[model samples]
Target: MQASGYSFKELLGFDIAVLSELFSSYTTLDATRHNELMLYFEGVNKAWNHPGFTFLYHYQQYVELDAEPYSYTRFFEHYRRKYPKEKGSMKLQHIAGEEMFVDFAGKKLQIVDKHTGEVIAVEVFVAILPCSQYTYIQACRSQKREDMISCCTAALRFYGGSPKGIVSDNLKSAVNRSSRYEADINRSFKDFARHYNCVINPTRSYAPQLFNIKTIYNI
Candidate 1:
């Protein structure tokens, strides 16, 4: 086979540095979709202060002027191969109606009282069924047991069915005491789960991977 005389930069139209920057941006932005990362690259190229620091410009030129198709999917596949460490672990298969994951969003939502004109930061409760990826979100005043139960009830009502188990974070409202082996579920939360014919499975303390619905689905 005859080897092409073109240099690597000539073949790819962009140098390795640009590719490295793109990868850095992908990780920093935490982009879940390939097109979203590509869009960010395009935006950076357009708004870059330094004309020499171009990103995706040559790729777009090749696609538009040279009749080559741009494939973000293929680029991402190659990127994953090149950066194996960035790949996530294998996802566990979930059974339908088996489990629902619930947690409060890390960031609080704000609401302004109409009468008092006071801004109140509220907790955002989220629930997701792993198999179907169905989600329920509600804003509550706090993560108190009553509020948590209320949110869970609303989530169940929204789904119109309860799962076999509810996976919850080790918050005080859900778990009375967190442990590595077996956490203690709060009395009210336990009763709520029992009423729904489901079990409350509290995730171990400091182990967010056990309740990783958000990480899996980018919720």
Candidate 2:
């Protein structure tokens, strides 16, 4: 019980500044796991001399004191209330006849054969003009080069004209290789676009924000 030598704040085993910093950093992180949060906290606050568990204990105490009803779940609810995350708008402005977005729907549609009582699943191809919100849909047997080209031709015919550029997902039929900086367009698809006097613009791999027509058009 020799508390005379140690400072009162040191004896408490927690620093309010450190705890607040940890909480603020935790709010920005995508991971909700305590261990990951602790790792990130350690990496950021290297000057702080404390064990990981000790930091976690102080965090728990801070949460309980700051949040009402005193539980980890309640602490998150309280945190969210204090600092709400900002949502981004997905709406994009487009020029008329500038771009046409095309993609295959995630779900397949079923087609029943008239002669035989059998149902066949078909891929749904969707094309949309961002400016006019005009849409064209076609069901194809597969997303092969020929089918994809046919769909694009049909969509253009339905619209009565072709856009300056055709925005497409990185499907194998359209894109030979997908890349962040530049994608390799398939030869057949390239010829199809040239014939129609439109450029093929493939979206970046794994990035939906570039060509999220479904969400943008409310389709």
Candidate 3:
């Protein structure tokens, strides 16, 4: 075969550019679908144990989009290459000014009354901003509904602004009933969210939907 006129380096560069362009083209993939895929990955990772919990399964829900969906294998490959850490536990993305995570610290602190020699053990409220990992902590009398709400409000003030929403574990002070689909948030907590123009999102420690999904996958 006759030798090509172009240098090996030049040919390689052209090939890369063509592949990148084709990969991002509207028919193969578009900005909308790309964004949706990232969000989907994030959601599924957090609730991976959720029902029908697979990328292919979730892709089925986006069939109406104009762009053709990538093949299941390709989809998984692309996401894994882009977000390897997501496959591991204890990895999460926090958007600054978007969300605040609240919980009571496992430890307690002592408060000494100035007037008397009595000491009080107080619960510690902890709120974290996912993006910056900045924390706001306060000592509260207890994890009662009122105290929880007060601490949340104070955390917002300390942070200098309010987030779009707040996330908490299913605690009675924050959640009335924990459900897989939607946990019932406490009325007082709901009011606090309204007052700050934010939302309350509660997560259960044990997921029920995970069980259903595993059963379906097994069958």
Judged by TM-score, which candidate is best?
A: 1
lDDT of each: 0.73, 0.73, 0.72
The Cα RMSD in angstroms, rounded to one decimal, for candidate 2 relative to the true structure is: 14.8
* Model 3 lDDT per residue over 1-219, tens place: 015465656656676676566345456557786777777667656756554355656556655452667677777776777668534444566676998888876557799999997999998787878787677778999999989888987998899999998888888898889987889887888888998899988776584211122222321
Q: Model 1 misses residue 139 by how many Å?
A: 0.5
Kindly report which residue stretches of model 2 are placed more than 4 angstroms away from their true locations once superposed.
Answer: 1-86, 210-219
lDDT of 2: 0.73
Model 1, span 18-103: residue lDDT tens: 65654453444333554444554554445544423333454455355433344746654544454456546786899999999999
TM-score per prediction, in order, is 0.62, 0.58, 0.53
- Model 3 Cα shift for residue 61 (angstroms): 55
Off by over 4 Å in 1: 1-88, 210-219
- Give the TM-score comparing model 3 with the true structure, all chains together: 0.53
Ranking by lDDT: 1, 2, 3
Compute the lDDT of residue 85 as modeled in candidate 1. 63
Which regions of candidate 3 are displaced past 4 Å? Answer: 1-90, 207-219
Worst 10 residues of 3 by lDDT: 210-219
